[model samples]
Target: IPHLLELMGFRSSAYLSHMRTLKTLEQIGAAASCRVGREDILYQFDVLREYVPVVLPLMLANVLCPSVLPEEVATAREHVLEVQQNIGENTESLLCELLHITAYRGNTL
Candidate 1:
């Protein structure tokens, strides 16, 4: 068990895998109109934003309650709706996919 733990130590394999793909793509001369190297960086940041809506419902429930002050509940509701609006920015075609991904792999995001 200790040997297995050492194999999966501090550095995560997923992050290493992502970096490996990015570097390998650049080394092999992948081309793009925009910067290809930046694509993965943007994706990493976008991922943080993309998962919010997926967990918002459960999060709000955990933090909120019918016993809480009415005003606090209202404020929390608005904040959640605002996040939903941001997720739906321009369009919400990806919302369903985000939900699916979160349901299947919430920890991964």
Candidate 2:
């Protein structure tokens, strides 16, 4: 679910296709970013107060009506795989993941 939500802003409704979603946010000096927390996924945007009216709709549109293009999914998958590979190489991260696996066992953490 987090992986899917992470792509929410990769593209938006028809009017905001390709890179327009991100480009529009960039033009307004805004940024759309997300992270997976221990319990939930956080999707946030930063923009000037005056631009909330504009940014809010766009942000909502991205969340409610994402394009989720196949190319974007492929790219995201590759990126995730690369990050996992890197984590495997980092001892601290590997240990953390191992600890979670061991602690959770058959349960979701």
Best by TM-score: 2
Q: After superposition, how far is residue 72 of candidate 1 from its true place, in Å?
A: 0.2
lDDT of each: 0.37, 0.73
Q: Poorest 10 consecutive residues of model 1 by lDDT?
A: 38-47
Q: In model 1, which residue pairs have backbone atoms overlapping below 3 Å?
A: none
The local distance difference test score of model 2 is 0.73
TM-score of candidate 2 on Cα atoms, chains taken together? 0.82
lDDT of 1 by residue, 54-90 (tens): 3343223322321334454455566656665676664
TM-score of each: 0.25, 0.82
